[model samples]
Target: MTDSFLTISGFRKTFGSIVAVEDVSLNIPKGEFLTFLGPSGSGKSTTLYAVAGFDDPSAGDISIDGRSILATPPHKRNIGMVFQRYTLFPHLPVGENIAFPLRVRGHSAADIAKTVKAMLSLVRLEGFEDRLPAQLSGGQQQRVALARALAYDPPVLLMDEPLSALDKKLREEIQVEIRRIHQETGVTILYVTHDQEEALRLSDRIAVFNHGRIEQVGSGEDLYARPATRFVAGFIGDSNFLKVREVERRGSAASAILPDGTRIENIPAHAGNGHAATPELMVRPQSLKFVQGSGAGLAVKVKDVTFLGDTSSVLLETGWGQEIWLRGAGSAVKTNALSGPLHVEWNPADSHLFC
Candidate 1:
């Protein structure tokens, strides 16, 4: 943490009576790929804007390499930004568009041409410099935008949902390109997006935001496996929540009674009070397995089955009418042949307790 290249400490932002971001802070190392991931209006974008010097924070400080930049104007921050919409100048050709940033920085014409060529090669669009923005496809235009952003060789790059405008296939393709560019350039990047898959695919560490606050920040596996809050567990991945009443507690973990009176133990009580009066069981579909007959678990009836090529998802309803889902290998569960009673069982350690 002492070697942090970018630091956001106690950041808070407000607009009139509305508080957009509050109490947000993070430490990013040099050449790190960190992502701000959350639903809309969760303050992710607001935090990024503050770092870019677009809006001054009501409280807290933002520093790059230990120097505060709160008073710096947006244009003087030397940060590159790529927004959701393509902001290319319509009249400028692809090559010139990438050269615009260099020209603004007063680089010599000879140096600008060299940088433009390198950027074009970096984005894998070497021969399209003569093409106009309108004449290029959406994916190609976004690539050019990326090339332009990197042309100036800014130490920090901020991306605000840059891939939101493209289709799924194109979006995925660009995600790969972004990763490659990050590796080749080694520039510290702060990317913003709401897509869980995209965040998991791209970030080395992710900060989850909600209602102007950061709920959690960690590696993809850490957040997915050991979430600190109920909201984080539900938001970062697919989860099925089952209502449960607290049966007992010991130390930091607790036990709870399921709907069918089956007891589950060793669940982490993240509330840290050693007690959760009203706790819900968070079980992933992949953790549940179909049992042949009723044992020490919840018995449910098959409601529906969906085959998704590599895996099949089975929807089950408890006797109390609560729905639960289980994912299995594609050939493991027959969608049409599924019939009769099926019980769902899981190891207590595989489940989480959230109150």
Candidate 2:
């Protein structure tokens, strides 16, 4: 933790009887892009605001460069921020807005001008320096706001759903820009967003928040492949949950009987409280494969199939009425024309078990 550039220890925020953030802790390495990702009111934003010094934690501390900054005010923390809305100054032209931060820090006018130009170039908005914010598109204004935040070269930049106001195409465009900017400057970034795609696109690691706590912190692949809890399994991707009866445990793996009475062995087991409660299976759509006979795996009746360009989604139902979805490449699935019961199979390692 001492090697981490930014450390948040036991951060908690309470509003009288309500707790917004509860015992959140994180360590962000220098130059690493870390994202706080979750749904609204899941404590992701509250934790970000605490780091930005907009709100104080009821208990705990935030530190930068191995030193505590809990006593520091927002302006003195030397952290830059972009919010859900563009906070650019409407009265100032783009050039002046980018120069404001440097000017406030008492940089010489010449240095401010130089920094502003470099920032504009970094964000690829060179010719629009003199244009008013109103004259620019939503994406353009956000780029200017980002330029202003980066003008002084803050050690950490915090972004909170900065592209939520833009259209889908524009949002994706700005996401690429943000990634490029991060790579260019190597500024340690603590980005906050509710979009999983955005987090997976930009973050070196993602901290998944839920119910005022971080359930897991890992790379996108880690969370999607091996989730720590039921909430995470459901949140990260398209997962089918099947209620299974726990048969036995062998070391870290467990044997469970599926709803269709097929026994699956060697599935990873993680019963959080050191005991299995009720066994459940979590499998991604793409993990299941179609097979020729019922002896290979569980049997399900094909209900529907939907084509989605590269992949097709196959909906299946167990005799007990449990629904399962599988994804196969378009060429692999000719089942849209073939009708009957089909067997679905998956490697035991491809599925996760939780209690």
TM-score of each: 0.95, 0.96
Per-residue lDDT tens digits for candidate 2, residues 38-134, read 9999999999999999899999999999889889999999899988897899999999999988888899988988888999999999988999999
Q: Compute the lDDT of residue 259 as modeled in candidate 2.
A: 65
Best by TM-score: 2
**How many pairs of residues collide in model 1?**
0
Worst 10 residues of 2 by lDDT: 270-279
Q: Once superposed on the true structure, which residue ranges of model 1 sit more than 4 Å away at CA?
A: 272-277, 335-337
| C-alpha RMSD of each candidate structure in angstroms | 2.2, 1.9
| Candidate 2 wrongly placed segments (more than 4 Å) | 272-277
Pairs of residues clashing in candidate 2:
none
The whole-model lDDT of each prediction reads: 0.89, 0.89
- Global local distance difference test of model 2: 0.89
